[model samples]
Target: MSMTNRLKVDRRDGKLVMAHFYVAFISLAIGGLAGLLQVLVRSGMFVLPAGIGYYQLLTLHGVVLALVLTTYFIMGFQIAAVSRTSGTLTSKQRKIGWTGFVIMTIGTILAAVMILLNEATVLYTFYAPLQAHSIFYIGLTLVIVGSWLGSAVILLKYRQWRKENHKQTSPLITFMAVVNSIMWIVATIGVAATVLLQLLPWSLGLVETINVGVSRTLFWYFGHPLVYFWLLPAYMAWYVIIPKIIGAKIFSDSLARFSFILFLLFSIPVGFHHQLMEPGIDASWKFIQVVLTFLVIIPSLMTAFSLFATFESYGRSKGAKGLFGWFKKLPWKDARFVVPFIGMVAFIPGGAGGIINASNQMNQVVHNTIWVTGHFHLTVATAVLLTFFGISYWLIPHLTGRTLTKAMNNLAITQGILWAVGMTFMSGAMHAAGLLGAPRRSSFSEYGGASIAAEWIPYQVAQAVGGSILFLSIILMLYIIINLAFFAPKGEQDFPIGEIAETAEKTPKILENWKIWIGITVLLILFAYTIPFIDMFHHAPPGSKGYKLW
Candidate 1:
């Protein structure tokens, strides 16, 4: 191609990209630090003097990192998807998207500051009766509104692409973006409703006392699906980006579609799984949520088997033999491949724990303990974070039109190992501690009075060591990304799969239509949630003496 005819890539430079990544990394780094600190405080290795600092950090770490990092990079990934498939975005769309990011960042910062100043220490859930500063609610509103706008910009451009390529079905990446938009539209409603009706009124003192049970029901109504919101993007990275980099088609595109559909349908009604420990709700209602929870597991298991089968198929194509021997044939040296691969390996055990948590009997034992935190951290922080890390490494070269240095690649691999190893140790310790009845969110425990101080001491110490290794992994990742962004050579490099440009001809549409599934999702959600929600309305105030805890 002539110089003038050569396609130009959209540069991920400018102040916006810089600002987004900077805020994202800082938030995540702080969150990672807080994780270690919590483990330390709980393990009795270090004393945490009672005050607002620990709680505020914990609160800020959970809410900010959960909201900011996930959404910010979902926008970034949208950009990558569009660029790879459609060349570049119009200047107008890019500005709107980044503007939304800026608003979200400021909102996140405001909320963080409020917590740090001890104005909002009610934990991540803005559950009723425990009101925050006006600024905290205001900040949260801004964050939600900003994310909506970001989703709008991405989806608008995606739809425009669809219009031009009438025959083409949405690419899996773009389909995920679409699903994310739809999910958010449904998912944010409960929290938004709670913020407006319950939290805002309570915070402003317009209400003398809010119904805590009703508020919690609504908050978690928005809460559980919010987890799927964090996870869908990670799964998108696995389904779309990984296969592209590894030179394989997705093993079962139909299965991938089912996974997304299942998420849309089941994620909403299962929120009561979090409420198993609380009293007041009818056992029958909780039992319904529990059954739906197990039903939801079918999709997760299907996903696990499908992705594993995808890897097996790839290995077989490369002339590998034996059942699990395909694991060795994977591109282990490539950070993009290895990080997510390791993440999935860790997710298997952690996910099983999640299944256990969904059970009424198992949940009663582990609820409000270190075990809950450990299970989720393993699934969310470790699994989702590793997937995002791999996606960043996988896409950064294309985004910058440069290949990362070999040294950077090696650093990434080493960090992935450390991250996985650290999580295994930490989560394993947490499981034991939870079984021993160690409480979460408490800084210390008196060992002698009804507690085994001697036995608890060693577990706490192991947690600290594990946490230290985790912190080191974060530092290593920061160093590698910084090096890749600044020092790596810039210019075209073959992406192994070929240059990631939109194919010139339109491809045929297969299963991209959304209506049938959306209808099913609506029906499934109603079927799953209708009885429990109705029962909540008919039941007496949850704290009545007749109410009982499981």
Candidate 2:
């Protein structure tokens, strides 16, 4: 059957997907504005208005953009991808999705209100002994719960499809989506345990103090994988959508599935790499996690190879002349391809920084520094955000029956370039300044006018300029999306789903063995975390009293 026919049958699911995108864009607007304020404040060029402070804005920016925007967008994108590739969601599944969305939206509103009112300046991590209102933690808990519910729905549909199809391999997009959902469920258990068992009780005064080290351990347990959660949806586009956009098939279906499975197993256990700088965690355990972190990189490397091969083969098929000449044969003018391609390029540095941060020796130099900030911007901000922006150009039009105009397409390409240029200036300066001992999460000027402090001023100025450019780029992007959603002419659009290349071997049956993969993932997590967690509880210091520095 045609995609249009399938979409017609799944019209209700499309509306749910649109709702998710709507919320995501709203988050981008609010968070993007907060980002501008942050750069200006950090540059020491502009003071915040009365009743608004740096930490508050920082918390708002982190929560909205990092947590809210990524979660909503991924859910929407995954649902759409699954529906398009597998089959329409059942009415029950749609209801489950909507229920989760409503719960999450309410939770976000409650948490956002707390932040805006200066009652929750704990930052997105919300680590103790810095405390916020009980409602703040409660709201975030609800958000996690909602997401879990939604994930359950997706899993149910996937299981149903497997039952009906019997021995057939799952559709690649659907397979990827299910893997991500399972990963999310596994990852969130850490945060949920910490919040419901530790933080929430303390916040509600049911407990007198909080286990600062234990809470942080749990947070990071979820924290690093949280990045992977944000990233995998973008990977879905790169693997499945980008090849199609480039007039090529996926290089290897088996490899793509294996990579996601690797992510499922390796992504969570590596969170201890984030805690290398902290005490209480043993060095041996940290070293083990560092090794696991490197293991996770293998899948990404495989993806890189596969993508390059796809491009090379496609170029050769198109009659390209030389080794590097194939680069020019790519569909660069297509915003759908160019935007995400740039995002993929940005990940080169971002992934490199991640490796540095994971290393025990190198992390000391960059931990709590602006270098970490630069690293994430290159990653989540540029790589992940730009991919979503690229996806949006087609996704919005696809769902809304709107034609993406040529002018809007050009504007999107321009937006992607501006973002890349801006991030280069901003993150590059941040990295340089961090190397010279500049701190992150501060809004200070002139470290008492020390000579070394003076060295940071030029980089700070560059950060401000770059941030302004990024803000402007986001504004243009929003304008384009708004037009596409509400004002563009109604029309049908192709939803790109790359095929497996004819030259590639059939996907291995071992790749589809979910039972084995899940078991191995569970075992790895147990091996990595069980002993450390037991040690933490057994030897833990007295819980710390809460503080409200803001």
Candidate 3:
């Protein structure tokens, strides 16, 4: 069956997908505005309104963009991918998805209202000792639960398909979607435990104190994998969609599946790398996690190799000559291709920064600094955000039955470039300032005219400029998306699925052995975390009472 036919049959599912995107874009707009405010305030160029504190805005920005926008957008994209690849969802699955969306939406509203009211100034991490209203924690918990429910719908559908087609392999996109959903379901367990068992009770006065170390451990357990949760969707685009856009085939489907499996296995067990700078965790345990962190990089390297091979093969087939001719031969004109391609390139530095952060010694140098901020910006901001932007160029139109006009396409290209340029200035400055001992999560001017502080001023100014540009770019993106959703001419859109170059190289059935993979994943997590957590609880210090700093 054709992708068009699949999409036509699932047109009803489009409403659910559209709801998710709408929430995502709305979060992006507000979060982006808050980002601009952060830079301005941090640079000493602008003061916020009287009732709106800087911390409040920071919390709002982080939660909305990192938690809300990414979660909603990823869920929406995966739903569309599954429906388009596998088949239309059953009514039950649709209901489950809508239930999750509604719950998540309510959670977002509760969290946003608390942030706006200056009641929940705890940053996205919501780390212990810095408490917020119980509603804030409850709201975040709902968001996680809602996403799990949505993922359950995808998982159920995938299982149903497998049962019906006993011998057939799932479509690459559908398989990837299901794998990601499972990973999410597994990853959120740590956070859910922390929120439901620890923070929620403490916040609600049911408990007077909470174990800070355990709370942080639980959060990082979920935190590092959360990055991969954001990343895999982008990887899906790179491995599956970009190849089609570039008139190439996936270099190796089996290798791609292996990469996802590797990610699923390795992504969770390495979260201790984030806590290397903190005490209570054993150094030996941290070292082990650092090694595991390097291990996880294998899948990404495999992906990079696969992408390059695809590009080279396609370029050579198109009559390109010379060592790097293939690089030049890529479809640079298509906004859909260029945006994600640039995003992948940005990951080179982003991934490198990640390695630095994962290292115990190196992390001591950059931890809690603006360097960490720069690292994630390169990752989630450029790599993930840009790829999503690329997807949105076609996705919105595909769901809405609208034509993505040439002007809008051109504008998207412009938006991508602007984002790149702006990030270059902002993240570059952040990296430089962090190296010079600049702190992160600070609202005040650091230097106060001291010579050491004076050194960071230029970088601060550059960040402000970069942030302003980014704000404008997002506005342009929202304009394009709104037009695509509402005012564009109606038409059928193409859903491109890449072919595999090697027809003879079938993906191994073992690659799809969920039981084996999940078992291994559980064992690895137990190996990595069991000792540290046991030690934490056994010799745990008296819990700390919550503090409301603001």
Candidate 4:
């Protein structure tokens, strides 16, 4: 589906996505600094100056990077993907896009101010019984709602394309954007419900106490799928864009769509795996959700196989021989490929760690441990972040009428390598220390000189070292992004979208049947949750009053 006509995101559509990217990049800087500070403080090598709290920085780091940055970038990327594949959005669609961006930006600001003021240091999850200010909850509500508006833009574009094309398979990228949007809309309902019906009123003093179990259950309902929300965009690039970048066709359009639909089904109904140890949820339900969680591994493995096949086919075309010779035929020099390729490798270990987290017995060992921190650092921070960065290598320049010159591409590749090395040290240390029983979500201490606490100190120092390297990599990334966005030479940068392989079977029309897929997704969610939710509410204790922990 690579456009041959001066391939680029249309300038007007470019502006819309760029608006979101500006905020996302700004968030990278703020959140990156906060992360660095956190690691340093945790290492006992530095203390926050007077009045600056460790947990406060931790909260800002989590919320800004995880929520603000990811949300903004995913929206921008999805919009760009759709516009590049389907024709440019109608002017009204762009207007709606901008409105959503403005609303989300305002909400981000509101939430940031509350966090900075230390009124909402309840951590990123904003877990109940540890309440934040009413304004904070309101800001959160706005963010979720605004994201819905953003999701609407994708649906509208896909709908318009279907209306115009009449039963044709939608552009693959556009179809992907729609899948992500629909998945997001369905998943966010849980968080939206918690914020509006529970947290908002409770914070406003309309309610005297909160149901911790129900609130947590709702959050995890949204939480695990939230991981998928962050992931699927990178998968979009991997399945669609990477083949084009490597000068080959996609392995199978049908397989790609099937994997996506599988993700949609399996990503939900599995949130309970995150709450495996939490009380008030029946053991049977947790076991059910855990089974559901393992089902996600199917689609994940499908994606892995697809990439392997794509790579091998590309290699054979280039005259490579032998089983592993295909690996040597890859584009090691292109920043757009190299950077995201690193992310793919990171996901190997990251995915393995996730499997452990999903298992009830294994989750107990690592639950609330810094190992969980290490896990997400690999998955989200390294894998997802690097892939997004890779997308920017071309996407930013493409949007800005600029070319990613050789120098900038080199810098981008360097940035990715630095991130990998840093993550290895930081995340590896975290996992090791967690196995030694170091707790997560806490500041550095020697536990009143207890001998066991001493075991964690070396790992803490290692984390600080890793964090410092990551900050340097962040600087490189920002520099590359700035150059691409503003100062690179003017040229057309092709937005790559792989064509379906000639031998591949036609994509089944049923894959695009939104009603059947979404209906099944809803059913799976209900099947997984109804019994557990009923149990949570029926046996609920008198809710506890909010605490301002910070």
lDDT of each: 0.72, 0.88, 0.89, 0.90
TM-score of 2: 0.97
Mind sharing the TM-score for model 3? 0.97
lDDT (Cα, tens digit) per residue for candidate 1, span 1-550? 2101123335642234445666777777877877777767766656556664666666876776677777676666655565545545567767777778878877888888888788998787755555689889878887888788777765776777778667656555666677777787777877887787767766887765555666787777788888888788778777766776777666565666667777877788777889988765678777877787777677778778767766787788899888887778888888888998888787888888988888889888988987887887788878888988887674655555667777888889999999988887888888888888876655554553544556666777778888889999999988877766666788664332221223223332434666776777677667766776576556745555122212
Q: Taking the tens digit of each residue's C-alpha lDDT, what string does model 3 give over 231-291? A: 9999999999999988998999999999999999999998889888888889999999899
Q: After superposition, how far is residue 374 of candidate 2 from its true place, in Å?
A: 0.5
After superposing candidate 3 on the true structure, give the runs of residues whose Cα lies further than 4 Å from its correct spot: 1-9, 446-451, 542-550
Question: Where does candidate 3 have its weakest 10-residue lDDT segment?
Answer: 541-550
Write candidate 2's Cα lDDT for 107-193 as tens digits.
899899999999899998888888888888888988998898778777877887788788888889889989999999999999988
TM-score of 4: 0.97
Model 2, residue 462: what's the lDDT? 90
For candidate 1, what's the RMSD?
A: 4.3
Model 3, 518: alpha-carbon shift in Å?
0.1
Q: Per-residue error at 81 for model 1, in Å?
A: 1.9
TM-score of 1: 0.89
lDDT of 4 by residue, 136-214 (tens): 9889988988999899998998888888789788888788889889889998999999999989988888877767787
All candidates in order of lDDT, best leading: 4, 3, 2, 1
Measured on C-alpha atoms, candidate 1 has an lDDT of 0.72
